[model samples]
Target chain A: MRTPLCDRFGIEHPIFAFTPSEHVAAAVSRAGGLGVLGCVRFNDTDELERTLSWLDDNTDGKPYGVDIVMPMKVPTEGSSLDLGAMIPEEHRRFVDETLLKLGVPPLPEGEGREGVLGWLHSVARSHLDIALAHRPVLIANALGSPPVDVIEKCHEHGVAVAALAGAAKHATSHVANGVDIIVAQGYEAGGHTGEIASMVLTPDIVDAVGPDVPVLGAGGIGSGRQVAASLALGAQGVWTGSIWLGTEEYRSLSSSAGWETAFLRATSSDTVRSRVYTGKPARLLKTRWTEAWAQEGAPAPLPMPLQNLLVSDAHNRINASGDPDVVAMPVGQIVGRMNQVRPVAEVMAELVAGFDEAVAGLEKVRG
Target chain B: MRTPLCDRFGIEHPIFAFTPSEHVAAAVSRAGGLGVLGCVRFNDTDELERTLSWLDDNTDGKPYGVDIVMPMKVPTEGSSLDLGAMIPEEHRRFVDETLLKLGVPPLPEGEGREGVLGWLHSVARSHLDIALAHRPVLIANALGSPPVDVIEKCHEHGVAVAALAGAAKHATSHVANGVDIIVAQGYEAGGHTGEIASMVLTPDIVDAVGPDVPVLGAGGIGSGRQVAASLALGAQGVWTGSIWLGTEEYRSLSSSAGWETAFLRATSSDTVRSRVYTGKPARLLKTRWTEAWAQEGAPAPLPMPLQNLLVSDAHNRINASGDPDVVAMPVGQIVGRMNQVRPVAEVMAELVAGFDEAVAGLEKVRG
Candidate 1:
């Protein structure tokens, strides 16, 4: 489980866990692997800073990372078009009618909302601003390479900057932009990903960026054996996101019980890669919500911020409905491996042990 | 690398090579991996038996396998509708127009054709019939599990029966039907495949089929490193196909010079998993011919034998035209890793050496 990255990142193992819950992040950091707190849900800048402060205190001086979603180009294409108006009436009506049909109740009175996810709003800038101000050991861009200035700023603060790439070309582009690490996120990965498998994508990106820059393999990875396979694919570490969703720490966080239950029952074939989540192709748990968007006569999802804007409220309703069948959550195919909820520390330990056993098994096979 | 499968199959390595060419199959067996000859294109039973006899003479008594395509359901559906009538006229015209547009020449006047691939003809059954008479060490089904009688006969002859599965459920079902080995083939593989990737699918199938039945991890595997990763995922061996297409032995077989050149110049991204091949979804090179089928107003590809009947001639024409960009062939994402052409012996040597290096690296990282 150990790699050169384990020494550089000040971690006991080469596992890097990506999770949205600050508690899960803290627990993972405390356990050994680097816990990257996803900053996409922090709508308020002060809230993000306060969450980081909480992670700082809870992790007991252990190093952690932060991940923010930032696509290369803004969804509002520099035009004066009102962002809210960008969504067609039919799309809005489809969301509204679907929520009504599914019996998902509206938010409680006085709970105002504006697209809960963070890619489009001005707060996205603040998420990075606050992340930089915090004591994070690394920064990662979920959508693409962060700005060159951001890379330079992180380097100045001695914080490593990694960007997720779904293709070798994207990895090369990230390398050119001075990214310290490249996470080769594959087609089976949650959130936005391209059409390549980790088995093929990891080696492709590793060769594309050369041996100097470290690559973390992502997608369909939830076991120590997969971590070992990632290394065999020439990755220095593994960047995992989906498995953490089922951890007890994460279940006790913001998400409802329904979200975790759906993950436990689902198999590898259950997830679908559709643009229903954020108007970008992402692998999400196949629910009535995603299926509605794919049905005939359903309006096409709007681009980026508008799509997130249109469905985030409905998402809030579904997650709040306490129904496991209709909950919407981004997850990888490895959900099949997440059979039960356990502590993040246990998950981390199992990963390390699995990797050691896999390595020993490799030696036996090398006879 | 030596795995239990190596001992069982009487080979030096755990590599299972799948190739349609007899020469490539012979070379792989001679090089110590179990060579699996694809019997899809063998329309003549006597000719197939003669090819098997030649393989028997050439392999130096080394163990080899045979792969035949036999979907559980026949394409004709036992209906009165003529198989020719099943393919819409629009589809036939589209293929003809696309080939003409691409300047792909027709086959030589005297060379007749009736869909050059398998899965639709009586020869498909005869393929298994003839194989049972041969000395093949193993028999595999490309599409699904072979008939129970076939499995029974193979077991009686002390020959193993393997079935390729793209999902865990399929593997369990294969095991239930008495397959001795389960091959978990992932999405990034060439020809027929499912949506799941090897990283997730391999482990899923291994657990689904249980440790008692040995599983062979397939797809996105071309080198020794991938082979090691397959074992780490709990597979006893790795079944490889597309990489053999680039071997010197394969190039010297029936394919055109144009076909060989396309495999050399392409990257992983250059392949597309499209149903344009044999009606069912199979990964193929992204060429002008495939693109033509995706254009607006293009007819949807027919299913099964109808689809194969509709365009096998187009495939024949494309390969016969000697155009590198438009030649049609089944391939996997590992085509990107195939930078040069080499003999089967050299490729086999590199795989063994690479497996050793990967294993050593794994031990080094276990700090």
Candidate 2:
């Protein structure tokens, strides 16, 4: 009954919950699964410290981890080889012109917030250091392959390094680069992903990597039956994100997280991936933000940092306005099946139950 | 620039191909994007003289049609579905005993191939009789759909019809009612299709369907940029089985094909639809398939006619397959990048060139 991952991670269950909230992590860990915090939204080292502290207090030492964004290619368009020195005059002017044309409010002069996406590596590095200091069980890199420094640092701390892959090649790269776990994410998964669908991706990744490194199937998985399927195809566990969006612990739930709601209720027609959020394509509830960028003549957004900066304030404003049409909520196509919010434990229990029922259903047909 | 089908049916191309060398009405017409033929595999008809003679001469005089067997669901256990129904009682007894042990292979022999599903509809009904009478445009139909009456009558009028969908929805009853188009398909296609791999099935049915219906795109179209791609998506015209397989062909493709390949090919680890194929859940290349069924002891395959015979194949296949993995691939996962095969004309030209290019470059990418 023990999963390969459960044995490797020293956990009781193979379920891995991804969230940006501390409460969710603590709850998942307390319930006998691993809870991995997404580091993208945190402001700094202090925030990571406080969040981890809360997780520590709440779960009473249950194992959990942290996820960060690491990309393979840095933008060659804006800044020079030195990121700060690279923002070209023409590009900066274009950014200004675009914000002005879009009627966006400017940042207050002298305000201390780093430009969105700015200091990404620095902040992530500090968080990793903070996480290492806290004795976390794992450290994950989202977006792309982690930098050598990040991998090296984590190894020094003896923390298991995990990387999220949208394809088999990525999984291979992760394993090659010293990652302990690989998250096989499909397009239906919430947030940024490649075009390969999950159904096809799982087995391919499993076949590509085989039975050594524990591979966790992510994106679109919300039930125990799905978990069973992942396992059937050689996944050691299931890494889920969308299910937690609607959970009570998620910070965005209080405001009716647009993506969570849309996905839970969408038919096939509703979802789309657009570069509206962070330049790179990400699946989310189809909205004007996505539509606007998809129109015939819109200029493509710059990659990550620039794109992130371009939309950060827009997202904040859209959030404040409660305009579902314009808000950006990274989600997977599977959000269509996530119709209700439930406790993490309940969610885990249902997945287990569903897996059993599906197995039995198959057995019945066989009979 | 012109094709045998186009010349035969007096339309555009010469792709007629599919069927058991039996029915050829819809095969001829749809072979070039115009007509479809009925099945002629099981030889369930009479008055062969009139049907063959008429279809032979009628061309609209355009090329006529014909269709036959191409099972979507391959038996995972309990013997290959192929081996035919003539197995001795001893073999049948062995099957029963096996069921008593491992437990699988639903449905009895007599009730097995009913209506459009049984060999009678595909092989008998003298589809050739009617085809010769009318001399149809094209012929088509795979394992999921195609009624006998439709194939026979179409032959009488010399009209064409095509049939083949990886998903049941794409295998609409209206299509089998009388079509002049036939598609020998794959998972990369934008429309409904069986779970069989396009690479595996395309060649099989090319022989199975007999160069009559001119099988077109079945799954995952890659490029003009994929004819450079179909050098991968695996079929002609990108039957484009996914949404935006062509922007104009949106609705038909979207039901079963989402953007796993379109928006994020690099992200998905692989693709598979599972029974996700016809409500029976066949494996697709991506999305839910990877996450839902990539595990150990997943759902067992059910008997074709009985499985969809009971559940709503068209409706559910449409709904579930588009989710990450629960439902996917009427064609094949190779179609993920089929976001654009470009114009049909470009795709055709590109296919020839791309195939050459791929063969030429094989040595370079091999290692």
Candidate 3:
């Protein structure tokens, strides 16, 4: 199952798992696949530093990466306060009204929103700086092309920089901007994505950037067959996110928010791409919150930071309320395949086995 | 370069070319790929029968298929005249006024419009009956799943029945209804398509239908590498349409409509999915006609048969005028790759060589 990517990252497999749980990340790395920790959840530098240190210690020096949401262009500029002020009152009122209409209760006192600071570029840079200090093997920008300075800084630190692109042109631009890897994310991918799907986009990116730059196929991928499909499309490896969300490690974090049940009950059709989540098209479970935003005459979602700010309180309250029906959970269509909550190591083993079987199946067909 | 699909159809390559040109269809079959003649253009049963007979005689015993647009559901269900009366006066007027605004001239006397009867189910059924009589190896529904009776009849005649689906569920339903093959068509594909792009949809359909049923990857595929990608995704073959539009055989037909030059010059981004042509979400060259209907306050395109009926005259006039900017030319993003005119034999040769090159490339990476 080893490819050049596996050797380059010193991993047992070329499967790269992106997750917010440090336990999951550590498990994936320990299981011989690169575990990429999503840094967008950390608001405090100390906390992020602690987590990376913990990962370093727990993984026994296995290769892992950090993922940050640093979009090349944001709707809001200046400080967080400036961006906050720019959000229209109408938009704020709509969010409040929608949540109220959905019967979502407010959060308990003394519990602040987690990861709100990650939407701001200033905060993301801090997270990036902390990640670089941890001797990580790779740094990936989750939204768009990484800034020139960020890419240069990662290269300077002997870290490979990856940027997620939904189109061939974006991959081209990322390669031109010195991104070391291109994650060709499809429309079916969780979080922010473009209109292109992974199957076409991976090969398109591969063709656009040529073979020199490795492309990792991401989107609705959650199995060994999909991984084989990605490699067949000329991707060096597969980058998966949603499959981990339903694993045992994620359920532990999600149980507190009362989302584990929702994740398990969901099907592929349960997800929708809506801008209400982050002012960009992100696939998430179709909850009341998403439904409200999609209603006719609903106030248009503000772009980027503004939209993120408008919904932050509502998201936090919904999560605190522990109400599955109204909670906002970013997921992919592959959530349909996430029917069981297994350990990270078990999931990794299944992936390896599935990939081998799929390759063998293809070989049989060729024969 | 051959798979079970090739052996099943007795072809040298697993490439299936969907074209409206009889010349191209015969050429592709003679060149060792299955040539599927698009029958939507032949409203007259006698004309269609003659064309199929011609193809049968010209291809030297090579296998070919017939493609008919029998959408699983249509907006208007009644007879042609009954559906024609349902088109609103305003919608009819809008089409006429839009054509006038575009300075499109009328058709020359005695030069009748070709292929306009394809939108009618009544006409498509006639075409299908004629195709079955001619001993076609396969019969494909270009828009949706074939009706149960249609599938049964095809099976009775020993013809393989194929249906186009844009979603996994659709493919599953088609398979349940006895579709012999699933053509997973993506949004980037020309003609009526769904929101799902080819990349995600193909694997989704492949998985939904399982390995026992062969799935053909369709949409923005134009080259050997894309063929390799499709095979990687577990598709038995690739069903291509847009790439054939720029071939020499199509140019001979398109030159009269003044679209040959436009097709040759288009970039990948030049196509848009608009309902202006067939009242369906079909990807087409972004001309003034498509742009006008897309403008704010443009009448929302009516449903299928009615929409097709309303625009029929305008489509006829636009083509007659021989104007490049206003002609409603259906195409896919692969149009960008079709930079020059080439013979069908040359195109087929390139696909074979490209497929080999791509497979070799993957082998090198795996090693």
On TM-score, the leading prediction is 1
All candidates' lDDT scores? 0.86, 0.53, 0.82
In what order do the candidates fall by TM-score, top score first? 1, 3, 2
Q: After superposition, how far is residue B180 of candidate 3 from its true place, in Å?
A: 2.0
DockQ of each: 0.83, 0.05, 0.37
Candidate 1 residues lying further than 4 Å off, grouped into runs, are A74-81, B74-81
Stretch of 10 with least lDDT, candidate 1 chain A: A72-81
lDDT of 1 by residue, B329-350 (tens): 8899999888899999998888
TM per candidate comes to 0.97, 0.55, 0.93
lDDT of 3 by residue, B1-367 (tens): 7678887889888889899998898999999999999987776778888898899899999999999988775434676677778888878787778888999876778764543777787788888888988969999998778778888999999999999998888889998989999998987788888876665577778878887899998986888767766777678899998888778777555535467777877766678888877877888898889998988778889877678777877777877788888878788877767878899889888877777665665555445
Error of 3 at A234 (Å): 2.2
Off by over 4 Å in 2: A72-115, A251-264, A365-367, B1-331, B334-367
Q: Pick the winner on TM-score between candidates 1 and 2.
A: 1
True-structure Cα RMSD, model 1: 1.9
Q: Point out where model 3 deviates above 4 Å.
A: A73-81, A112-115, A255-258, B73-82, B100-103, B108-115, B256-258, B321-324, B364-367
Candidate 1 interface RMSD after superposing interface residues: 0.9
True contacts reproduced, candidate 3 = 0.24
* Candidate with maximal DockQ: 1
lDDT of 2 at B94: 35
